[model samples]
Target: MATSVSVAGFHKPLYSTTFHGGWGTSICGDNSTVLIKSVPEAVRVVKPVRFLPVMKNINEGKGLFAPVVVLARNIIGKKRFNQLRGKAIALHSQVITEFCKSIGADAKQRQGLIRLAKKNGERLGFLA
Candidate 1:
């Protein structure tokens, strides 16, 4: 079961009269308020879970099999991390084993690739 749940939405704020005739004067602007339900209330809404290979790659490297790293890398502001978006899936354990078998990367080289991918995510603020 998921641990955290929340529902948030934006609503316009109410305004009181101090109305001025000029277009320059009004009580309301672009202001909005966010409403969030309590955790239990939010949990009542069942959300679908998605499983993606990219998420698996990031999660496994970080030790949890969680997939948020893919999304974070896309927004991490580094060209290298951005380049890793869809490309990181090639680093998955299954994929890596296949590639290493094909190219004969030694155990040391295999470990290096794992570290490199994990380090890349951590440096981009995605792993944490």
Candidate 2:
């Protein structure tokens, strides 16, 4: 897993005015106020958003493959199963990519492998 850190800052001036004899006097004379706010505290809020997907390991073979089997069983008839079977490998690889991403797999590498799986399925005529 990889952690990405970032920092940001914002600054604004606080101003005030004062009245003097026969005139409005800018007593502060545009005193420059400097606020050096450390951004380390911000990581707590942002870490979850960026790493939400990798919190738990997604066991692809056990978690996802079982559901595919259950769904394959529920199809109405042989014809439907046959049709679904033709698409099974490609669909399996797509789901695996999602599972990999959830379990901290590098996005670019995982996607490239998934594309290869899809292309293989297509070459084998499993996908038209």
Candidate 3:
């Protein structure tokens, strides 16, 4: 006989267990393969989980004063931080472009984000 177990957030039963008095129980979860295959390709892409705000701040001319900027300077040293800060727009564009690339975003999507960053930076009185 097969026994089913339900888990929260999953539409179907997660797995099944078969019982045999002498052998105890055998567990199997054939649905895992199905679940893995069901995931969308876009969901598999890798992207930065943090630092988006930092990118935005830098683009808005808050380079040296941004908390993340201060943290990064502390972590990477002032010399390297200054190098990136000297070319804020380039650094911002590069960071956003890299994020887009990591997430497998198409060229149009990448360009749109870069443009938005530039617009926001300009509106905030920052040069980009």
Candidate 4:
């Protein structure tokens, strides 16, 4: 007698079992081994924001060119760049939130940071 068993579309099996009986039942082919691996928590990887380049330029005494560069960026409509900038902004908010939590910021102080982030986000075109 010939028997074949396979699990399709499964990359890894969490558990496997083999039964040996008095009737000569045995694993015919490569034995399936169950591997227990510790899956690390999903990490939020914030990519570098494209706006950093422009910000760096402005910080390096080229502030006068900001408006022109921003206008050009707006006209170009770089969706991916904008998305990255949005992610950067969200990461910034997360950092702020963590800082507040660590320092035990009061309700009033937390609210102040929230308002400041929102206002700066708007001014920097990070928020709609």
Candidate 5:
């Protein structure tokens, strides 16, 4: 007797019982059977994949233009560099908010878009 298991688009007997009470043999597609211990009423659970977004600033001195950032950091110093980056990001966000208002988008929609931008930007190694 064979025990059937359906997965994906493949419908076939996953394992066959040769005798009583010890083991079951699973048939591979290439016509090979491997012995697997049989258990009653087994439930299989697969873990879902989770994605983590990485947040990194370009000015932290990494990438093709690392040298440029290093030089800028050296010249402008840490405090001023942070100030410029903060100002630029704030200006960009303001521009987005203004554009959204101009388009007659509601506050809820605008907030959602802003949050999405932050998430996507963080994933893409930009300012969040």
Candidate 6:
């Protein structure tokens, strides 16, 4: 649903407003009650459960696996997917943390390992 807002004063030729994901604007010639139509609410985006925002690579099956991602999104839905993905990522991070602790590795080593993993992933190509 879209809503219109009334501004009483603003004697300006152009007025504008912005929202996340995009922007909109309005224009008026004189100082009057301006009825600016607000941009409609953005359609809620359903991010895939398996997608990691941290991975900035393009070949992470964004195009090739789009169909599968859509199917999974339809099956698992937004809320459940979020819950599961969050738990899974947390668990993986915890495991990595524990392993680092056991190895007496500092932050630098952990980051280096992460970089090495990225490099290996790129070499593997399918998952990069």
Please list the C-alpha lDDT of all candidates, in the order they appear: 0.53, 0.51, 0.61, 0.55, 0.61, 0.54
Across 14-75, the per-residue lDDT of candidate 2 in tens digits comes to 33253232111122233322111223555435444544555432332243254555455565
Candidate 4 Cα outliers beyond 4 Å, as residue runs: 1-76, 106-108, 121-128
* Pairs in steric clash, model 3: none
TM-scores for candidates 1 onward, in order: 0.29, 0.26, 0.32, 0.36, 0.40, 0.40
What pairs collide in candidate 4? none
What is the per-residue lDDT of model 1 for residues 1-128, given as tens digits with 9 covering 90 to 100?
Answer: 22432224323224435433322122233221111232357565578887675543343445332346545655685577756744655547567677888998898888788778767656554554
Looking at model 1, report the run of 10 residues with the lowest lDDT sum.
27-36
| lDDT per residue (tens digit) for residues 1-128 in model 6 | 34555556433233347432211223432322332323233643357568556846665544444456556656999678667756765675677778899999998887777667555544444232
> Which tens-of-lDDT digit does each residue in 1-128 have in candidate 3?
34445445333333436323211122224445445566697896478676454353335435433455557777999888778766987888889889998999989998999899866655554442
Q: Show the lowest summed lDDT stretch of 10 residues, model 3.
A: 19-28
Q: List the residue pairs that clash in candidate 1.
A: 55-67, 59-65, 59-66
Model 1 RMSD to the real structure? 16.8
Distance from true position, residue 64, model 4, in Å? 7.0
Candidate 1 overall Cα lDDT vs. reference?
A: 0.53
Clashing residue pair totals per candidate (backbone < 3 A): 3, 0, 0, 0, 0, 0
lDDT of 5 by residue, 53-77 (tens): 7964644433455566557767999
- Compute the lDDT for candidate 4: 0.55
